[model samples]
Target: MRKRKWSSALLAASAIIAAAGCGSDDPGTVSGSEVYDTCTTSIADNVPAFYKTYFRCVTITMSGDTVVIKTDGLPPHNTYYYGSGHDKYVAFDFSKGSDYHPNPNTLKQQNVTIQIPAAPKARGLTINAAAVDAKVNSSSNEYGLGPRGVALDGVSLFNPLAAPGDDIEDEKYTFDPYNAHPTNNGAYHYHTTSKGPLELLKKLGKTTNTTPGQAEIEVYGMMCDGTLLLGCKELDGSAPAAGLDSQNGHVHDIKDKAGTVHFTGRYHTHVCTSIGSHKYTPEIQYYDTCK
Candidate 1:
């Protein structure tokens, strides 16, 4: 009888060990060179599954109600910003336009870690609330400049607003082929519609379109307050429903082209330049809690 009990206990221990090992071995797709390595698949089970499955070029972990994301903040694609010596570097295309000129800053790896609520709440009543903290202020839904969120390619997403006295419309011409540029400190980020996120979807076999506004389905990234950055169409490759706010945003379920539902009643904004007057990243934060 003692031998039988020992056998059962040993089996239980083995099962526990297997379960722990399974978390990191979750079919990760590690892509990229030494410049920017992307490890998207081998993530802990505690992290939200959507981020684990769809996102690339970052390492994700969860701590209680907060989701912690760590990335080098270097885009996994070719850019003139990567500098000439790097493998990912490309010569700037002078043919893009007469107004389009490369910014002086160069791209480099960044140690960026952002913490956000795993399950964010919408600010229905707090829409008009007073400000307290800039990171999670209620009154000020305005996104502060610099590193608002992470893009699909592990790049940073800045708000639509440019620096003080600098015109954002003018800055759009400074973006590279992927529609992104670096800050004065060398932090590369996306400010408007880009082929970066759409290209990732195509690489993952999720879609065939890679164009910015013309893609079949385009999704940029998640903001601190759980706002989804979408393109011309919804995730299912259909037209965005009517009644989008002035910011070209609305609350709805976020699903993929394959009919997999990722979030329910989520706030998402469209940044498609082809469809409407709004043609840049979202300015106002829709959800209540950011941290």
Candidate 2:
């Protein structure tokens, strides 16, 4: 699949003003103001199957000229903003699906409402009565595949509009789509880190400790034989049968002939933090190319 670029118009309209630069100590600068006009963007394509339950029939409500996001009838989803120029990134915790359980049958047909402060300096946004289920089928990967591995065949990342002076690395970062982890049923889920939704909170200038609401590190590439390579910590004990452990900044050669990837790590549950010295035991699944 071709890479997609976030619309520049949308980015410009959604950009937030930097308050820290003005020596403002107020954390509520962005509370309860709708600056940007409310617009809806569909996640049906961008969101992987693992996150489908949370995204299906969802509508994103953006405050005019501000970064606040509201949703209707969707699972608790995090919103992150990576600032441009000299602006620092910030994340907001909207709601958690795990804590609130709604009837799946009713939720599927319900309409949810999310409200954020208007733009420029909106704050204290609240999401209310959004009908949704926190039931993330632990049995399946976020994707719909059953125990069989989910194929990465159609996935690719590239810039749609590359100018001569554009930084290649930046373009890659913007276009690259991370691979999803497979569940015991071969279904795939979009790990929080891959989608850039949640913002990562840093402690004392350290990149390792991520505070909830910040973006999780992205994992890319898979060995033909099923070894998963990621940019985060290696929570899984030994490397898979093939491929390099990119998580630790070390590259390994592929040893398996089938090119099947395996995620032997534990799922980090922190909303804005990394897995700190924790061991991970992944649920196993296999994927093949979609014909």
Candidate 3:
């Protein structure tokens, strides 16, 4: 990712949100040797093929049992959020919906670190109180004004929560075509369904002629606490099985391209609004901890 100076306004906004940071350091600065010392295989070298196919402009590596992902939080598509002079800038297309309105903030690069377990488990674990307060509220499942996960296009994933006295459903009016909007600090994030990741998948030929009814199992990204986020279907193109918990998560064997099982019986959440009732990314942390 490119390095850029953090604007003073952004720095002030960063003080209010936890996911804010300067894009000065390159995520790719650490060499292979420096990233995984004494561990012959680098994390990026061993990550499942799906990650390589989905994630772009980011660095992935293993730090012991955890996978360390460093991203410069910026979407790869055109949006009015990119502002007028930017090359990727595109005026917001108001034809999609009448409620479409642009937020005042513009897109700014962010340095974000996501750490997830290489092999996540169900364990039926409860999030610690401290982590809960830092990330979200335990009762309402409202996101704590920070990143809960990361999207394939290197954008952050926030839970379905709005600021005090504001409801996310009401805030949806401000979203761009991709169902994303930046915070006052310029932290662009997804609270619900994101067309950006789906568009990336389609462009990569990972999906073809997909519809809401016949949706395929698509990987979006992973949460900081080791939970994997998926669309409406499983990797095998089947609907998610029943018995998903409040977080829209369950333990199951994840399959690969050849129909071979990987991450056997691991915990994952489905944010597939097309196929399931849970339309937003994980609002509650099913795992015990997150960094």
Candidate 4:
């Protein structure tokens, strides 16, 4: 989470994307509360263990039945978008594949505010968790453009669709080694599998590897629809169940490797290309409205 800024002046001059700002952590910020040494912020106290323990680079709090997550939309990883003068900048690397190349846009600070259900239910199901219809939430709505979700490492999550005519399968060439790229507005995000969040989990002792299929466990992040995005294996280091849908998604009790159950019969999906060619994030939303 360490990014070296060239100078204080440059920090002051850096322009932020419009219409973004959030926080008011669990207990909210109180001046300068040490969060990251690379940068410091006065995050709130009493924050939920989910946000406090698993996430960074963002501020969060519980407001009624919702988890109000707010982030500046910048990832805590090296990439070409950080700009040459910035420390997070690593020269454009197309080494992973010949198709890799830099995009025309540069990274910019994003103003993003995302609100999701604290306890989610499938769209066609009643709040009581009983199915009433066959209609499921569509990716065209919940997964629409702009901050669809947030990665554990404080990055945004976008869909696989590219800019109108472009193909996301090809646009990935523009992504950094972390498997992420910025949009026209400069917000960096992930649409496919990436080593970024896995690396974070590694540092936290949550897993032993960062490689997708090989990683002991791979939990990308949550979508706005309350869909848990997972990779090759389930959070408990077990194979996904037998009833996954076309998108490799299914519902069951969610547990960490330690066997601590988090959610019951929750909807989640695996998107690891190495596991089976499920290369893109789920395009369909299984849950109801995403705040």
* Leading candidate by TM-score: 1
Best by lDDT: 1
- Show where candidate 3 strays beyond 4 Å: 1-43, 48-50, 121-143, 210-215
lDDT of 2 by residue, 1-291 (tens): 222223445333323322233323222122222121121234222322222211122333233422121233221222122222312212322243232221112111122232222111211222111211112233232222212111111111111112245432232332113212222222222322343221111111112333222323323222222324343432222222322211212223322112322222222121112432211112211222211
Q: Predicted candidate 4: what Cα RMSD to the true structure?
A: 9.6
Candidate 3, residues 1-291, lDDT tens digits: the string is 223232445334534342333332323222332211111112266665545545655678778887777777888778889899998889887886887788899989888888877666444555343333323344543334588778876789887767767777778888887888999988898886676666655544456533422445477777877777887777766778987765567778877544857567777877765544666776666665566
CA-lDDT, candidates in order:
0.72, 0.23, 0.65, 0.69
Error of 4 at 224 (Å): 0.7
Clashing pairs in 1: 28-41, 28-42
lDDT of 1 by residue, 1-291 (tens): 011111335445535654566544333223221112333323355777678656777777788988777778888788999999988889987788898999999987888877767778876723221321222223366887788888877888888777876778788888998889999899999987788877777655556789887777888888777788888999888998776666677888888654768888888888875665667777777777654
Ranking by lDDT: 1, 4, 3, 2
Q: TM-scores across all candidates?
A: 0.80, 0.21, 0.75, 0.79
Angstrom error at residue 277, model 2: 3.6
- Model 4, range 122-207, lDDT digits (tens) per residue? 86621111221112332333357668888877788886656566777778788888888888889988887789888767655567
Q: Candidate 2 vs candidate 4: which has greater lDDT?
A: 4
Please tell me which model should have the higher TM-score, number 3 or number 4: 4
In model 4, which regions exceed 4 Å deviation? 1-34, 37-48, 125-142
